[model samples]
Target: MRVSRAETTMNYVLLLGFAAFALAPVITILVTAVSAPLGESGGIHLGNFARAWTIGGFGRTLGNSAVVAVIVVTTATALSILAGYAFGTMHFRGATVLFYLFLLGMMIPAEATIIPLFFDLRTLGLTDTYLAIALPQVAQSIAFGTFWLRAQFRALPVSLIEAAALDGAGPLRALVQILVPASRPAIVTMVVLVFMWTWNEFLIALIMAPGGRLRTAPLGLANFQGQYTAETALLAAGAVIVALPTVILFLLLQRHFIRGMLEGVAK
Candidate 1:
């Protein structure tokens, strides 16, 4: 069962190769962002970012994206924890059926439902608003969150819950004081994923908030691309601006995220 040093070294080298392959495009983009444009050669064009930010209106769009992500992540995580706890611990009639209904949200693509969703939102006068952008993503995140957190909750020992109950703790108290803390990594992983998904989402934001008043960062980046087809450095700079938040978030929470993912696999 033991691995030799040569095997371990080989594994590390293979992993490095795969990592480099994955990072190659990102490296290219970063290099292109700083590189001189097609003409008028000079030092690395750091000014491209300033120009892109101003021209793309990314300041507003980025703030909109942040607002939507916070709303979705907060609502989805809180609801998912409660749903996960109920499904994982307390069994009831129709629980399986209801859980499968939630899973159906994941099975259905946003593309499939976006048109009708837009119509529905418009009918409710919710279109072109922050709620319009945040709500659907909240629903999407909840489906996965329920699936993820339920497993984590179910993995805890039954004795732990019973012990809390014996100590006069109610269901809410037991969950808040013990289970939530214990499942912090999984919860954090879910938060990071939901934030990234909400941030990167383009289609929903495009269709739901079409007035351009509530454009998210990705939406703004798309518009920037259209206007700057000839400007590679500016395009790359806009892309970096759009992608930077998610990258920073992942870097910040990578330890917890990796632990949560490994635990999910193990479970």
Candidate 2:
């Protein structure tokens, strides 16, 4: 079958329209961030970023977010891979129930759990610490990570695992040497998503460690707004500053991310 020229032209038009529609807000944000200040004439004022940085204390807060994201993504991805492999490949009693238990973590919202988490972490003397934010996020990330990787692993060909076994390789060897390498695309996708979620997490970070040295970027931006909302250019610049890392990250790994997602859906 061949697509006619008319149909191809229509497809391109629709795609371009959708692309522009999606990109409109991002273009607006960039323009707003760089536009001349009100009542001032300039090509593109760069001072707004400087002002937002100083006012927002974005240096400290972005560092805090980086730390949390690294810890959460690393810990959660490692744990999820192990758990997903076990649940997807191994035979055991109550496995369905256990997997469902992990799924419950995904079903529950952070808002519903944040209050109790605050008290619990405070009691454990972990509140206002990086761990306070990282722990819950790790748990949350692991839930979805486990679900994602489990589905990916279950879709693997059984003959591959059986071949490894016949060669006298144990489970750990089989996983690390064979399955993990084979599942690179799926794992990269999970890492990217978990990093994005952990980086942008606001509710738990705010509730668990508000107004202290542990304030993440979003919290810092929130506080920045309260003090400097009148400066719209600076505010827009601050938003752009905080969002840049995630955008850069997604752009770098987008191919792997899309491949992983497609693999998950295929399975």
Candidate 3:
């Protein structure tokens, strides 16, 4: 069936409307962020960024966020790949039960678990540290990562595995040489997603490192906001500073991300 001109026009119009709705606030933020921060002389400039950076202590916060994101993504992806391969290919007793237990992480909300999580971390003397945020986020990322990569791995040709086995390839070699290369797009997509989630995560950061030196970017921005409630331009600048990395990451990896989604959906 062909789409009519009228329908196509309507679809374009609706898409443009949605785009505008989504982009308006972002544009507003960019405009405000670049504009002169309250009473400062001259026209739009980059000084707001400088001020926001200093005021928010973004140097340290961004470093903290980067550290957490790197650790979580690395650890979670590695674990997920192993777990995914196991669930996708290996048939063993109690696998279903264990898989379901992993799925329970997906079913539960972070808010529901955060209280106990904080207590557990505090008891372990990990609060106000990078692991406080990294571990929980890793757990969350692993749950979804396992689910996503399992589907990706499961969709691969069985012949590939059999051929690798016939060639005397160990499971580790098979995963690294055969499966990983083929699953690059899925892995990249997962990394980008997990990075975005971990970077923007606020509640966990706020609770885990409240007033601590190790606060993540989001927490730093929040603290900055409290101190500068009247400084809208500064706030906007700080937000952009905090959010720009994820935006750049998504833009860079959007193709692989979309391909991964399409493959997952198709499978």
- By TM-score, the best candidate is 1
Per-residue lDDT tens digits for candidate 2, residues 15-56, read: 999999999988888888887766788789888799789878
Question: How does candidate 3 fare on TM-score?
Answer: 0.95
Query: What C-alpha lDDT does candidate 3 achieve relative to the native structure?
Result: 0.91
| Candidate maximizing lDDT | 1
Candidate 2 wrongly placed segments (more than 4 Å) = none
Quantify all predictions' global Cα lDDT against the true fold: 0.95, 0.90, 0.91
Q: Every model's Cα RMSD, please?
A: 1.1, 1.3, 1.5
How far residue 103's Cα lies from its native spot in candidate 1, in Å, is: 0.3
Among all windows of ten consecutive residues in candidate 1, which has the lowest summed lDDT?
A: 35-44
User: How many backbone clashes can be found in candidate 2?
Assistant: 0
Model 1 stretches with alpha carbons more than 4 Å out: none
Error of 3 at 174 (Å): 1.2
- Report the Cα lDDT for candidate 2: 0.90
Where is model 2 poorest over a 10-residue stretch in terms of lDDT? 227-236
Q: Assess every candidate by TM-score.
A: 0.97, 0.96, 0.95
Of candidates 3 and 2, the better by lDDT: 3
